[model samples]
Target chain A: MLSDMQNNEFQTYGYTFKEVGLTPGEIARFLKVDPSEKEHPANVFIHEILNKLPDNKEITGGYRILPVDDLNVKEGRLACNNVELNPGRQVSTCLQKSEYIALFVCTAGDIFTGLTRRFNRRGDSLEAYITDAIGSLTVEKAMDGIQSQLEKAMKKRDLQITDRYSPGYCNWPVSEQKELFALLGETPVPVSLTGTCLMIPIKSISGVIGIGKEVRKSKYACAVCGDENCIYIKIIKK
Target chain B: MEDLLNKLHNCVEFGKTDINSPYPPDRKGQKGALEYTQELLEKGASPTNIMELALIPAMNKVGRKFSENKVFVPQMLLSAKAMNVSVHLLKPYFRTGELKRKGVFIIGTVFGDLHDIGKNLVAMMVEGAGWEVVDLGVDVKPEKFTEALRQHPGAVVGLSALLTTTMVNMKPVVDAIKAESPATKIIVGGAPLSSGYAFSIGADGYGKNPQENVLWLNAIGYAK
Candidate 1:
């Protein structure tokens, strides 16, 4: 229903939703919306997923890598687990190093539905609601997307994807967004970054697939990278 | 007097919500869009005159500033806030059927993606341009969009994704919408989205930002 502009915020943005449910207060604060407003149903599920997020695990051998389009020998060696991690070992005894590794990452991709209805109601701050919902959904989607891609890419290579890693995770500095971008030639991939390196569209994903002989580079690396607090993590050593 | 509109526009453009609100340290304590809008309204100003001469122009400026990288999210949020304050004052007349929206829009972040900021911005900007936006929230399934389309008939649909991985999910949703409602226009956006990608995914349009989405909607002559 459209109307002449009055002091109506709803009219400014037709339908709107505010962050509602569990962390609605926190999200509302982040989105700069009034938290006391009626809660949106989407926020309920968002909280549910957030609460249930499995601890982030560096799932070794969880995925395989496949060249989505082309695979050239010039790109380096493509060896299965044949390559030995010991640099001093005989080269002939090891699998040839593939110049670059392209693997699909995957994780359990289950969240809830009806988020919009829960957030955007008949009478509410449409803009504020949408903003809050965007923030919540983006992170959830991005993480899942990256995980899923790793899983899929690795399955193709027949070699397991050591737990996916990005530059900023663990010892990896946030500054690696650039190197990672360069490695993937991300500009052509439709993904971009803000001035502060925050990924937009919030639900987008990114990750790294190591091209090494050791199944996981090293078990220690995997342990350090495991997000023990993640809702989906299968194991939590802590 | 000509510069007064620019000043008012800038106040809103930079996100000065009201005369009393303190933000953007540079414009602290000054009359904001809220005051200027009310003042304009009381001065026998036509609604169209206020919109065309002040509000629209201000948003346009903000949009341009945003495109040029002179401003970022915080500044844009402020501008949106200022614009909202003025719009809040204009709501009653519309509810009374004194005004009309150009059309309806249904938007959301695709399944597996829970982000909504970019979608929200588009919703706001489109609404400012006189569209009734039905925000489906995050992780929206295609059926919900189809359901909304069934209800609205010709409403435009916007899909947002912030992750490269979640963008894949958009294809199935778009396919579903196209299968059920061939004529419903769809728009896609987010960090990992581009015009090329939007076309590949079968969306009718792509918006890089809220302001751009407004311009796109207006350019298609969809607004009445």
Candidate 2:
């Protein structure tokens, strides 16, 4: 059903589950939506994709992570507080292949398309627009699924996940996206990293989590990040 | 009536909702899509006709604009909001047989994929195109889709996944559905998915954006 161009774009623009060090079952758990049922659209889609998924070997070494504390945590140093202090634990996983490819799609399509469908129902733009607001409200709940899974995984590892942070979150610059990509061995997966650091095709994600042996209170929003919240109280605008 | 339709179209295209909505600065305080659509229906325009001539066409334009990159996510979302407002006014008609939807379209993010923005957009867009949309919400499993299909036998399905890691899981779900109900059509989308990925997984359709899906469905002779 997919066009040739669309198929090619998908191949280049997105990554497979194995490429990101995850299995279908693992992902299913994180999403909390099973694919075995016929009623779920996501399950149907996933079922189709898995049909052609290549069996890639598990890649052992691609990422090179240097703890923030080891990099530049000495006294009298130009301090950037975003750096993880005490340089918490580190863990990395990747596919068995030498490289991989990926993409980045946006959340915009859901809002627009969702609104159109709802409005058509009422034949009244007013009610549909209100529903649109309600629909957008679900974004938080959606992301919650991911956060909860990560939390569970961390707990199992006897580690505390300190605010699962993506590349562009807080002081983590977009430039750093390249670093993570390199660590993942982008060339093997054949992922194209765009100039602006956005993974093309709009579905890819790269992030880092500070895994600490101890559980500590964390500021939810970047604005109140504790490192500076106590001393300067300069809210890092989210 | 034509002027009102034009304004309504513009409101949806430019993301204007009503006097209170301020996102699209170009048309502030003007009666937006919400009011215009209601007015059109009140002034002897059939909801069906209004949907066809005004809402559908306007949304098609917005969808085309999105595909061509003329508008980004935020602007597209605005237009969607306007379209949604217009749809809400005509919902009851849809329920009582005053209107007939083209077909059923089911959509959701795949299991283990919680992101809903893309899936929701496709659901809305397909629904706008006059299809009876059954949204399964995010993190939907294969069995849920099959179950929903059992409930709505002839419905077309759309799958969405935001993560590359979870995209592969769509395969088994598709297989299960095809095994049980081979006649059901499936559309796969999301950032990580390409047309190749969709077909590789054996979906019946692929849409780059919500508008494309509408056009594709239209070409299948469902446009009204």
Candidate 3:
């Protein structure tokens, strides 16, 4: 039994490059160019790509807090109301003390994917690459919005929320995305899973956040994750 | 003619695709690789010379900058795009055997890995470097690679896998290709791959990025 959650009821965010907190310096870093140079050609290229994005485009994400019926921290599993989840170590470790959990889905939407494909077909792969990066940043910003909303809701209940944990992260296999999507009830962001379990819109993300008074967020979760290629970790190091 | 060729090289190096392209603001409204290549050809510059002098040198500079970490995929892709436009104008010469391609290179992402950004980058870079690239698209199987090898004999192969889980799948592809053609060089790359892991999986080389792969191909005499 799944309950439909209205997309309008949850906090959703739309972003431009500036609103997403993406700086030229960060874009330069991602491009592996010298950020010290205030007027690099890459910076100009970044601006050009930004200007080409649709003004009406929005990357929306929202979450619903669901009651957890049971949780087993040692076994790294949880039964959240109607959905039984084996969230794995990384998620369960952060979720053990939670009374409830929030299931969230965020998407940069199909517009960006369509734009990327168009650029690719036109042989403007540079624009395609930049658009793809922008999509990533948009989804990340949407996730940030979802986290803040979850935090606010938890605060009203005298509880705190743990860091966001997606199924593909750490020991939680990507195959579990089906269960996560199922738990979220109706699609909040129009993201679908492929036959192989990969997310469509390519830039969409889904995750779970534990809500409890004792759930503490890690200061630097990227450090513990061991994925050296993570953009967040790279940004922190720089 | 030399001045026009030099301008064409600069256009490609800086990723100026055309007069309408707004990138590299300093060159705004200036004729880019497309116009410059056409103008150079009109001035009676040899197609082979345009490739060897203008396109090849520009791509080499881009590849070096990429290896030095001075440019990322966006920058590299721009440069590759510029080079591609110039190459397109010279395609007639290639078809006539007047402008020879270095060799055939087949590339694809391994099965279960739907990611194509990295694969596309590599394919474009290699194509810009004067190779004839046969892109097999994404989620390719080992048999497909072997079949491609059968079709394009003596061609080099590239496999990409963005996920750690799918990276392990490269071993089977590598083994299958090697079994079919022992002389064929196989390279692997993606976010989760390292040169050490590439070697462990029987891959001949591992490129940290597309530029590195171009460099490796050059080093192995894949380019003339």
What's model 1's TM-score? 0.53
Candidate 3, residues B1-224, lDDT tens digits: the string is 88999999999998898998886878878999999999989989999999989998898889888777676666777788789888989999998999898888999999887788989988988887888999998899999999999999988999998876678889999999999899999989998788999999899999998878988887886343
Docking class of 2: incorrect
lDDT order, best first, reads 3, 2, 1
For lDDT, the strongest prediction is: 3
Q: What is the lDDT of residue A234 in candidate 1?
A: 19
For residues B47-117, write the lDDT of model 1, one tens digit per residue: 65556667667777777776776764445656766777777777765687665556788888888776665
Please list the residue runs of candidate 1 whose C-alpha ends up more than 4 Å from where it truly belongs after superposition: A1-238, B1-7, B222-224
TM-score versus the correct structure, for each prediction: 0.53, 0.52, 0.79
The 10-residue segment of model 3 chain A with minimum total lDDT is: A1-10
**Residue pairs whose backbone atoms clash in candidate 3:** none
List, for all models, the DockQ compared with the true complex: 0.02, 0.02, 0.31
lDDT of 2 by residue, A127-189 (tens): 333333322222222323444554574467465544444443344444555555543343333
Against the true structure, whose TM-score is highest? 3
| Residue-by-residue lDDT tens digits, candidate 1, A1-238 | 1122111111000111221122545554343344453332224333554554344431111223322222223332223223211111211112223223433222221222233334445333443444444434434334444555544544565544444444334433434454444434323223465543444433234454543333343445445446432322312221
What are the clash counts of all predictions, listed in order? 75, 90, 0
Which sequence of candidate numbers ranks them by TM-score, best first?
3, 1, 2
